[model samples]
Target: MFYPLKFDHKYIEKVWGGRKFENYREDMPEGKIGESWDISAHESEMSVAVNGKLAGKTLKELAEMYPQQILGKDIEIEEFPLLLKFIDAQAQLSIQVHPDDKYAEKYQGESGKNEAWYVIDADEDAYLIIGTEDCTESEFKKAVQNDQINQYVHKVKVEKGDVFFIKAGLLHAIGAGIMLAEVQQSSDTTYRVYDYGRDRGLQLSKALEVIDFQLQSGKRKGLKVCGEDYDYSYYCLNNKFALDIINIKTEYEASGEEDRFYILTAVEGQGKIIWDEQELELSETESVLIPAYCEEYKIKGNLKLMKSYVPDLEKSKSQILSVVE
Candidate 1:
């Protein structure tokens, strides 16, 4: 079937992820809100354009309409496998963790959450809480009880165009005023640790039950920059199920092959992707999926893109040539 793309909106009741990212504006005259973003928004599950289009349609629509043009040759129809999102942190998000494949199999067999963050925009002092700093179970529990979590987790200053890979079971959160895009395994299971003394009627007992005690026993130093920092490239914090990032003024083209489907997400920029007969234009914080069976795909029009496909650089030359040709 042919490619179907649409723009869907996600309105979360949570106060942190508001609707600033969805309507972002630039400094130039026409640059006014060319890209989609959120200032205080949560649950970046919406804005899914390519695969599950038409604002909550059936899976059959995806299968019959955009089959060869959505997922790849190696994947199955039942395994959508990935969930893409755009998140804006107007305020600090909850310090939380997730369950990996093994843990999820044992505890939540149907749920596995592994996600990565691509920094779309950040303040001069925007910082991120990734993993733990140094806290034993007792100390962590006490900190949680007293609501003093700032001393427990590792924090790092961040900037636009930087990418951090967040694996399942990693304790992390986005600080205030940071906009990001996330790609993950299609599960939304999250365990919140602390929430800055806010009363949402949610208890922390559930989080304590799932928190990993082993990691807290060890110390984790945040990604450090001792001196001046410039536009640093993507440093994969973790690649649990996929690769994620934030790019700038660039383009990526994945020539169709027998391996995997090409997932293209635009964190920032104005660009067009050429896939088979489909010519898709992408703006900031938008995402699209290009199926593998499709013909030679080309990407033009300068933009920052984050791309993920199953890593198969080890394929034989004959097989590689057979597909791209």
Candidate 2:
């Protein structure tokens, strides 16, 4: 009934190759020398419980082993809604854009993408490629053809604790020397317009098909934010998915309705989360799922968090659900 879900994050090549966190397994010599990456690159958010019932399986395996628990249970987690990741971009990634849900279903028969970033670390000139300035689709296509889009792409310097909400069709990329946690719709549908010619064997034709000329996410005028009590700042950004950034210090509590569950990822700081009959101390890099039933919950300790949830995937209830296929 109580088991930890595990997934494997397969490493692919990157412009700024990521460091292997597993290499520094508790190897500190009394001096906090370097960064310790605890977040794993996982494929599945293993499902161990279904509507408080013991399902005892991973989302991937369970989809097959116990499809009933997943597709037709008291609480249906049809498929993992989002892909959560912690990225330490040592180099600039490819400048790309993704389709929204409507476009996805119509063209690719897939779900669209809506992603947000919680800046963790940055350098003196770290920035983000938000969108281009006064550029039309024809101009963008011309640039893409000439392999000069990077020069035309806009950039904005970033800092820790800063948040960037990337909606579908937004032309964007994460620059080097920055690390952050990203919570996004569970779709890997990125059409890279420019990769800086990093990958030896790269493809471009497929990317052109998905790139939308009419859609452009310009520089952020302002991200939705509010005062948490009198000291900290919190923000809300939503599209296909909903994500709330709550800056916690000393004492802070979060309130939400019983619409759906929540994945509370501790992107920063040390804190204790109090839920229905349980209190947990979360380290720097840890995430826990709060059941939808626990309507009222609170968080204590000094922390900054990125919590993700599907705003309206609630009533997909089936009379019989399987834990895995």
Candidate with the greatest TM-score versus the true structure: 1
**Which runs in model 1 stand beyond 4 Å of their true positions?**
2-7, 22-69, 201-206, 213-240, 244-253, 275-278, 312-325
Model 1 lDDT tens row, 74-169: 555434566666666777888888877666667666456766677888889999987776677778879877878778888878888676767666
Candidate 2's TM-score reads: 0.71
**For residues 1-325, could you state the per-residue lDDT of candidate 2 as single tens digits?**
2222223333344446456333322322332122222222224233333323334444455444543422223335556556666676777777888888887778767678888777877888999988676676677778878987866777888987777778776778888877777777776667767777666443456555655545555333333334554133324345355566666767766544344555677777878866566566665556665544444567788877677766543322121122112
* Prediction-by-prediction clash tally: 14, 23
- TM-score for all predictions? 0.73, 0.71
Residue 93, candidate 1: Cα error in Å is: 0.8
